[model samples]
Target: MSVARKVVIEITSDNVCPWCYIGKKRLDKAIARAPSNLSFDVRFRPFQLDPTASPYGVPKLEAYERKFGADRVEKMIPHMKAVGEAEGIKFDYGGLIANTLDSHRLLAFAASQNKQLPVSAALFAAYFENQQNIGDRETLIEIAAKAGLDADAARAYIESDAGEREVREEVAGARQRGISGVPFFRIDGLYEISGAQDPAVFEEVFAKIAESA
Candidate 1:
């Protein structure tokens, strides 16, 4: 008799972080390629790259230019675009960058529905590939509906402050854990990996864990 080995992975990420998107893509690939005997339970925790950004949103390029300088943003874009293209992501600088608090709230609700991953992916795609403003309530409800949640319920939930406290607390917990950046992975709550690492890194870790089990 073979018993499947189960592993839990908690990813702390801000929806607007480019590196978090990249890290998620790589992690999904790694999980797909892992041994059949290993099953993964992936959950997401909240983080905020810019908590003070407006809900109305601002152009990603403009925000970057303002914060990092136009010259630096110009230098950063090409490299980010090249890296993103390698991962099959169409990076767009014209997308909106806004406070991700509402988006985080939506994700918390998705977790209860077991639709978090798809919802998260949809949000990232909307902002990074489709140039949609994820901070908008309507936009988020649309994303939730597309991710297999009921649109009306999503709208109702987003209109209220249902998960705000929990989301904020989780974000604070992540920071208290000394995670100063997005794309941080807490594997099995014991082993940790940070940044948008290569898929092979995850595969190796999974293999080691399985062997130990």
Candidate 2:
């Protein structure tokens, strides 16, 4: 018999969403536990949790308060810190912001070259760990290069609005699917999982997909 076709996983997430980051880590771990013979293609889609964010980062603390309310964010910090520790991911929540639209566009550019996941990871590291303003064109290009994209060409593309249409299309697709949050995962383009869950959760999902094939 012919081997089963690989599944495509569509992830709709904003880089600024900490849960999205954690969710990706969990998904990675889950995929690691799946059947070796099975194959899958992961695609990160665009979702702007905060569409009104300015190009320049807003003050991290204030921005969080505005997005989720002061009390709620304050209560969540300790939990986020603990989760970060568990995942070996840093929580510089102090320096990040709510702007990720341009970051999404840059990911689209990277996707055009089949380098979306690496570029997206770099973008996440730049903003969350390195505390860089990922929305900045220069910064985004640099991250894109680190993710194996051609830096000069990426810079040019970002500056010339060459990938804007593709970015918009992805955003529209997300909207059409009724995705309002980050880290949304559609496994094999069929099974859907939302939220930044545990690595075990991803493993369970991966097994299900593999078995079904």
Candidate 3:
């Protein structure tokens, strides 16, 4: 019997993106249904939804009102809530809106320790569920610790310039590739799947790729 082919999937996403969170959940479900004759290596890449957002952050409603206007944001709330519920995410967008660069940096640090996914999930929950300020160093350190990373090391890593350059370059590279959105998936560095597609969509794509391999 032929050995299962190894597939690498790199996900470019931002913690601030609601669709990214949903996409991650859907991807997890799809992977669970993948054929037995396949192996997977999944990595999370960085993307900044708002690079210039203040480090101190702003009230969620205020930020939303300023950027997308009150009426549009208001209309989006129910839809966002509905989608999040379907994905088993109880999104509470009552937190502050801050720069996610630091969060991205923490994720890079987590990647080094092979704790990226947990850290990423924590950040998402902290921001969307617990409504915490993820841009704060202390908050990030705490989240990192909860994800099995050393608190002191995570703090030092976020405080220093360790992962800043790499994160910036990755975001820039995404832009260069004409990727203007989050939750973008690249399979085997060849096939591209954009947005928060359905699990069946991901499963079908995985099947086709595995067959071709």
Candidate 4:
């Protein structure tokens, strides 16, 4: 038997993005289907879908309509909902506009504690499923605690300007790389996959990486 190949996958996404959540689920399924000889070190990177969003946020539906127009928003909803349902996610696109900066900062803090993935999932669920305002400090602290981080530490981190600069710089770097969209995946620092691609696409990429290894 050959040695298992280790691959690093860095996913640049925003918590408020429904497609990112779906992409995450598909990526998980693809990883689960990988051969035993393949190992993954997956990391979540920050990308702001709306950098100009207010910290207080606006109504989700209103924001969507304002940004994408009512007609397009109406057409996009059923599609997003269908895709989310297929991925076993119930996306409740209720009226809760979220400023994802604080959430991204929390993710950065979670990365320090090696809890990035769980915290990110919690944030996504809170925003999309539970309709919780992830922009709120209290909600974020609660989500962080639920993800196994120290609540007090998380609160303190949020109160302070701890992860702000890092998150901003990471977002800037992503933009500098010409990445204007969320759910962008960089595999083994070589291959790039954008949007909520199919599991077969992810599987094919993984297989190619494994074979090359």
> lDDT at 187 for candidate 4?
94
RMSD of each: 0.9, 2.0, 1.2, 1.2
lDDT of 2 by residue, 1-213 (tens): 668558788888888878888888878777777787577688888888767788787778888788789999989888888988898788786564746777888888888899998998887777777788887878888788888999988888888877667767777788887887778988875678888877777677677767766
- Score candidate 4 by lDDT: 0.91
| Candidate 1 deviant stretches above 4 angstroms | none
Could you estimate the TM-score for every candidate? Answer: 0.97, 0.91, 0.96, 0.96
Write the residue-wise lDDT of candidate 4 on 72-179 in tens digits. 999999998888889999888775776789999999999999999899899989999998999989999999999999999999999899989989999999999999
Residues 1-213, candidate 1, lDDT per residue (tens digit)?
A: 788899999999989999999999999999999988899999888999888899999888899999999999989989998999988999987878889999999999999989999999999999988999999999999999999999998998999999999998988888887999989998987889999999999999999888877
Q: What is the C-alpha lDDT of each candidate?
A: 0.92, 0.80, 0.91, 0.91
The residue pairs that clash in candidate 3, if any, are none
Candidate 3 Cα lDDT to native: 0.91
Q: Which ten residues in a row have the lowest lDDT in candidate 2?
A: 93-102
Candidate 2 wrong stretches, greater than 4 Å: 1-5, 96-98
Candidate 4, position 146, lDDT: 96
